[model samples]
Target: MWGGCWPAGPLRRSAFTRRLSVPISAPEALLTVRGLEAGYGKIGVLHGVDLHIAAGEVVTLLGPNGAGKTSLLRALSGLLPWSGGSARFGGLELRGVGPREAAQAGLVHVIEGHRVFTQISVTDNLLLAGYDLPRAERMARVEEALSFFPEIAAKRHEKGGALSGGQQQMLAVAQGLVRRPRLLMLDEPSAGLSPVLVDRVLNVVRELQARGTAVLLVEQLIEKALGAADRVYALAQGRIVLEAATSEADLPRRLERAYFGDDAVSPLEA
Candidate 1:
């Protein structure tokens, strides 16, 4: 049984004032999934999937569209009700959990399309995301989140709707960060951004990981997501067909084959 993310105490007081060096120590899995199942409106989209993420690790979910990659993220984050599975993160089972409960447990999901409160100032959006925090700590985290995206720091007071597309995406991530999550799941974060901005956003992601925040990334940009992953899982036809360490030499070809052509491509290709 997993213990859930925290020890039932206040979050450890910490500040990400600057980019920290990537820790050399490898992390053990902090999230574990077995036989997970979830779907939309009674139609199942994820079928008996299993995956895991280690503390401070970057795990990427990849596959062609309609492969149910987003479904897995939603299921894990408690957005879609799931069935017949055990998803234990930091010692808590998540299958029947609600989104607010999940977030309070330190699993924060930044959904697809750069969702934000368009009418609110960037700072206000961040503040709202940190609503459960005490006043002083919430303000500190808002500043900390803003620090990661200096390009948008100057625009913190501006209405979210007024920022350019790329900036809003950055703000979406900052909103998630404001919650001080132990596991941050992002879906299609690079959508609608230039190559340069895409790189910029991913860099901040890497920085967050470096700062010891676990990340589960769902991305359509194959190369970019795989490049940042320490491990990768390919979801297809609502099932996981491949799982491999990012260091695997033949992973690119393997993923290309598993993701593109027909068939299981070897059940759970190691």
Candidate 2:
């Protein structure tokens, strides 16, 4: 389900696309979802969804609120039960994988709402995620993540609730990073941040990709998603309505229609 390298925007290139195209040297797809159907208590929010992400790629799922974006993230994280389809990570099927199992397999999901441990200090929040690793390795990752988010380390002893909204989001992402996940899933990462903070967070995402971590982002910020993702899958009414390389010339037009119906709404490409 991969192809040759194409320009990201008038001739930019992506290692992920180039690697996915090679049948022999290709790395196993980091994540694949086929006919995925999931919802809350049989409500059937997602219908026959299909998506894939290769190792070291950034794929964004963009849609309006209630379009089942959050549901899909929950299902992928094993928080919600999937009625049908298969989610496979590195050739291992996720039929019976719980959240713990998913994390163990290198898929770390960072949900929105900044669900950090409010009672714990910021440092403890990050350390908790790396508890499974040996002391040296965990400490090394801690240092690395802190470099990406020096604010957290500076406020390490502060309670989670004491931080600002942006700080909390940073902590959430930093926590996920400590896990050293192969596939990082973010749900509405920029949902409530200020414009500057949103940009900062996206920069952090780019850094993760530069370090070879695959990112699957669920974002309502249309422009941010397009700017950050190598490719995109747009969903409407619980189904995939559009899939395109982020670099396509008609991407903005198509995305507007998918996101705003027949209205003249336009998504600004950040």
Measured by lDDT, the strongest candidate is 1
Over the stretch 92-125, how does candidate 1's per-residue lDDT look in tens digits? Answer: 8887898998999989999998789999999999
Any runs in candidate 1 off by more than 4 Å, and if so which?
Answer: 1-27, 261-270
- Taken over the whole model, the C-alpha lDDT of each candidate is 0.79, 0.78
Candidate 1 is scored at a TM of 0.85
> Residue by residue across 1-270, what tens digits does model 2's lDDT show?
101111122211221122121111225778878899988884889988878888999888876556788888888888989889998899679866799988988899998878899998987787788988888888888877888887777998999999998899999999899888899999877867888988888998899899899998987666777889888887665777677788888877765565444454355632
Candidate 2 weakest ten by summed lDDT: 1-10
TM-score of each: 0.85, 0.85
Error of 1 at 213 (Å): 1.0
